[model samples]
Target: MKHYPVGVFCDFDGTISKSDLIASIAYEFAGQAGRDLVRRIQRRELSVREGVEAIFRAIPSARLPEITSYTEQLTVVREGFDQLVSGCIQRGWLFAVVSGGLDIFVHPVVQAYRSEIEVFCNHLDASGEYLSIEWDVTCDDLCDGGCGLCKPTVLRRFKPDNDVQVVIGDGVTDLKAAKEADYVFARDSLLRVCREQGIACTPFESLAEVIPTLEQEVSL
Candidate 1:
């Protein structure tokens, strides 16, 4: 068997969790306004940053805690996430969550793997009555839809020069990041784009399937 140094960067919302927490927050907290903002984003009419900001900003700042709690309670992270994280560590592979989403909700969901998974995402200012992103990691010009933090840039910064880069994601925000990877595992909207663009990829429905595939790729 052949071995390659591996670095895995995964999208947070739909890939790791059964549902997109941002959409949950927007629709649950922001109500009709959130629905509208999400619709625009889905249609590619709004930049991700613009749509995300508008969605959260529509909600009262006081609900930040409520949103966080709700996300944790309602979101179901795919099965085998624990084993996948353990498997990566056992193989000495780097693992990270590179999300185009906010930390307000992501923190609660992914905190369980804080020791093993490095998380890179945007922080939101919920101190006011509405939510707006505070970009700690800025998006690059390659991003046309305003992903506040470009996942590809984050991947480049963390992945070693000699290591093989792998990306797993499920949405439009993941497009640039998935393209930068040497091995791609895509699903949902991201999967559709990868197919259309002729990008080499593996499609999966759950994290349970991802581990074996990664091991297979690393073997040769």
Candidate 2:
């Protein structure tokens, strides 16, 4: 019997890392004006794609490396993250990082478990003076939200092989995906959305709270 065959999809920004790396880059390179746009995005006044595009457009391409490096230097993966990965591995779970942000920073922060996790995130085009976005096609099917790399689509790909669907996230990008999950581990913005939308989710601040649930729920 497959004691643990759950597939897990996690959000990268505030969920895994201590904070939003892209937002840090935005505040630094996009300036105060870009910060305003980010707020608008957070407030749901602007779409995530548009707001992210505008922020990157404001940043000079040359600063991409500096911004990524700075964000990586400060990024602290949540305590128990590696342990969570190990638990998943031992239990036969597939853990994936599905982020709306670019891959440049995602890889570095999760490098220790590089081979363990599958990453589904956007790519950057920094050839010009200003960085440009080349959104990833993580799923061929489009979500109603029109997220370039739809998180639900990523889960769908693994659903066939995996008997259970699990998602952990903390922000706007996670809202829709959470609804589709059989189990949701949420905090911050995602937790709020789950409550408001009537999606049942467990609120957790660290991976430690989540591991036992995974270990106990042998079948979904």
Global lDDT of model 1 = 0.79
* Tens digit of per-residue lDDT, candidate 2, span 66-95: 977787686888977887877777766788
lDDT of each: 0.79, 0.81
lDDT comparing candidate 2 with the true structure: 0.81
Q: Candidate 1: where are CA atoms >4 Å away?
A: 1-4, 141-145, 218-220
lDDT of 1 by residue, 23-127 (tens): 888888888988999889888889887888788667777777887778768778887677777778787777788887777667777787788668888887877
Off by over 4 Å in 2: 1-4, 138-142, 217-220
Give the range where candidate 2 is weakest over 10 consecutive residues by summed lDDT. 137-146
| Deviation of model 2 at 33, angstroms | 2.1
69 Cα displacement, candidate 1 (Å): 2.4
Q: Report the error of model 2 at residue 219, Å.
A: 3.3
Q: For candidate 2, what is the TM-score?
A: 0.91
